[model samples]
Target: MTEEDWIAHDPDPVTAAELAALDPGERAARFAKPLTFGTAGLRGPVRGGPDSMNLAIVVRATWAVSRVLTERGLGGSTVVVGRDARHGSVPFAIAAAEVFAAQGFSVITWDHPVPTPVVAFAVRHTGAAAGVQITASHNPRTDNGYKVYFDGGLQIISPTDREIEAAITTAPPADQIPRRPVHPADDTLIDAYVTRAAMVRRGDHGNPRVALTALHGVGGELAMRTLRTAGFGDVHTVASQFAPDPDFPTVAFPNPEEPGAADALLQLADEIGADIAIALDPDADRCAVGIPTPDGWRMLSGDETGWLLGDYILSTLDATDAATSVVANSVVSSTLLGKIAADYGARHVVTLTGFKWLARADAELTGFRLVYAYEEAIGHCVDPAAVRDKDGISAAVLACDLVAHSGAQGISITDALDRLALRHGVHTTAALSRRVADAVEAAAMMDRLRADPPAELAGFPVGATVDGDAVFLTGGDQQTTVRVVVRPSGTEPKVKCYTEVGLAVGADLAKIRERAAAVQQQLLATAQSW
Candidate 1:
């Protein structure tokens, strides 16, 4: 469509004016590519172009969502809608709610912003046909996203995402679509979420000091409440980042996994001599952890925290239930969790990299329950039953429980990790990313790797599995076994590589860990050249 057509069809005159003011070349770039539903949902800059996340795109996407639900015989059923504190979040959320209401479904939205997981929980709690959360999670300050959860509270996958894209392509313009005004729902949904999230704590033994930071997102208030309800009252927070701020002035990147994003939290931990630290992503769907070490304060990699939480949860389950429980992680994550699950007589599952796949892992086992799931990107599902998606808030509660249990035994999470390493070998992980000019270049890079697979990576003789999708490289050297998964990034013009190195703990565990980490660095170096 032309700029004039888009401006005429835009429901909001403000964004329409923004679109109208663009010059020809600028307009061409804005309309270069329309946003497609992928990597969970629609995410982009909240701007006024058809390609950007404006009212025109949101309205059409919601119409498609409503149509998809209605096609499945779910018309007129309740659908929960919510948003986080971000640019255009309020209007986008209200527009989505009204679209659902006009499409003949009951709409429930919040008066204030909320974490992404709360929207997932509210979906399952209220038996809503679906849920929509307007958030960007850990993305930059200028971005926003739309995530949809079905009745089970897991993000939609497969043909559903594809179908929505097709429907959006043919959907009517925003101004032509009908919408009914919808009011915010009561806050009982938030209360229910807090109560259930606090139930993830498995122990009540020791008092450990805790420090947390929300990174200027909307999770601080509820995270504190959940911790307080779980009997872990000794908590301190990074005051500057505790409140919701869309600008995210304190950190260059809002993601806790990014370097220096958790600096303030660690500094506060050192100041308070806290037993543990928690860093929640902007929307509180991912959690990164920090702990004091003999050397200094250190933040655990997502995989290390995964091992600790996996071992702790498995150790606490009833023996009877252990046999019927499952722990899961993505294909590219460290394999140590599988070893821990095996030691506990439980099963482990490796799925495509996303919570949509990890959250639904139990379906494959029929009768088994998904006890836990973690991705190397600091996403954890400590209480999948309460909320099928990755929930940093619930994961924080569980992390505190693990800290309390370790403190009662006069041990630390570091000691716990060491024990796991001694039993299952040291697992070190890192990533290699190569940015290209565009997705086409990224695809060519992946295609070249698939056509001529590497015989060895980082000096280890390697074996490759070149499926049409991603390339998985595995090999073993004298000191370590290196595993790597390479694919193109979903949101950027780059190819991403995830590498992990494993070595059996020898007489000197520290030396073995160092060797493994060195191998990881070499593996990343080799992958970078691809």
Candidate 2:
């Protein structure tokens, strides 16, 4: 079914009014499925009439959010609005503010561009009932999105998003959603965020040559300020994308993980002989690091970065005061961290992939301090005291600190990784993705796999299979038994298959890598067939 199919059969009367206000093509497009506030709020292509994240969609989403707060006796509740440097992000943010104001909800808007993590932090720090950020994260330039956070400063999840979506789905006409008389977003939130972030330190690292790139997004200023605050000097900003450009002119998706997104920085690093290169995506919540290794400027994987940050933070904090348990997403590389925590005498817990899962697992209640958290997708949530959401700013600072500390110890961050690998026996992982024509197709494929899982995958005997509504996992770690987990992308049109191979190489890292490469290819081919 097309986008029109989702909206063609709108069951709610409130949806009809939104349809009437749109032009013919727009009405058909939006009627597909009104963007509902999911656990992470609305995110999609920016052009689907009222249902999509156009000016109209932003207005309606804000109105719906404000309406929910008002109905819960917070009619004049305050909300914070922030936006990244994506196409139409600023306009969508402003539109969200206007709708909140029109609904008599107080709105505090950021004047300048900011990261989504900071917006989440602001919602918690300002004591606001909700927050809105306009960004599609790592998606391509053609897309934009809206994200909402709960009062505790994390993304709304489960029944909460469902409840808000229900209200939005059954609300009055789009034009009828309430608005206040004045702009409530004082625009001072930006300054507050800047000041707050500038307080984090990078230990004794001072006056180091660091190359920074924003990937044509809005992270440059924040990253520069952060480095300066951490006592780094002689920082070089890559010229092509030093400022905010909604079009993301320099990169295809503004995601640092995407191929070639960091090419400019890599070139700049080579020209300037910089020590390391740091890249932030459009929204800046995710960061990538490239170091000038003997092999030239090599970008580190999300797992490597996570290991460095987690180890550095745990080592820095006093063991006596630190929580006894550390939490990480299930898909993250935990080999190094597992070893680190074991040496530190801390328990390591793994939750389902995603920040939403980490935030809701109540690690704190369970005696887990949540000192640090990360996923394999370059997302990190550090400084639980500052923001329950993932903040690349803190993670970046931590990385700088790790580098500085390693330097102080007469070593390099890479050396530290080598040490961890030596200690942990070297674990390797890989993820493969297959794009489907539609979500229905993806779901149907998942259903079929659940119904008839193979006893063997790629000539390897299957240990067991996990069959869930959204995914299927068909293996366990054993001799000649491989592990593969298949799940549909929660926010995009792709089926992701994760494979892991654990080989105890006993300090023979090269052999481990070669075997892991062969296993990755075999698992990938098997996954593609599904």
Worst ten-residue run, lDDT, model 1?
Answer: 487-496
Q: Per-residue alpha-carbon lDDT of model 2 for 158-227, expressed as tens digits? A: 7768777777666654555554444445546656666666555546754557888877777788788777
Q: Candidate 1, residues 1-530: lDDT per residue as tens digits?
A: 67788889999899888878888899888888989876679888888886788888899999999999999999999999999999899999999999999999999998899999999999988889999999989888889988889857889988999988888877888899899999888889999999999999887877689999999999999999999999999999999999999999999989898889999999999999999999999999999999999999999988988999999899998888999999999987899999999999998999988898899888868889998999998999998788999999999999999999988998978899888888988888887778799778998998898889888877779998965468999999666788999988776556889999899779999998878878888887788778
Task: Tell me, by TM-score, which candidate is best.
Answer: 1
| Candidate 2 CA-lDDT value | 0.72
**What is the TM-score of each predicted model, taking all chains together?**
0.97, 0.89
User: What is the Cα-based lDDT of residue 60 in candidate 2?
Assistant: 59
| Candidate 2 segments exceeding 4 Å error | 1-30, 48-50, 181-188, 323-325, 331-336, 363-366, 454-460, 467-482
Each model's lDDT comes to 0.90, 0.72
CA lDDT, candidate 1, residue 124: 88
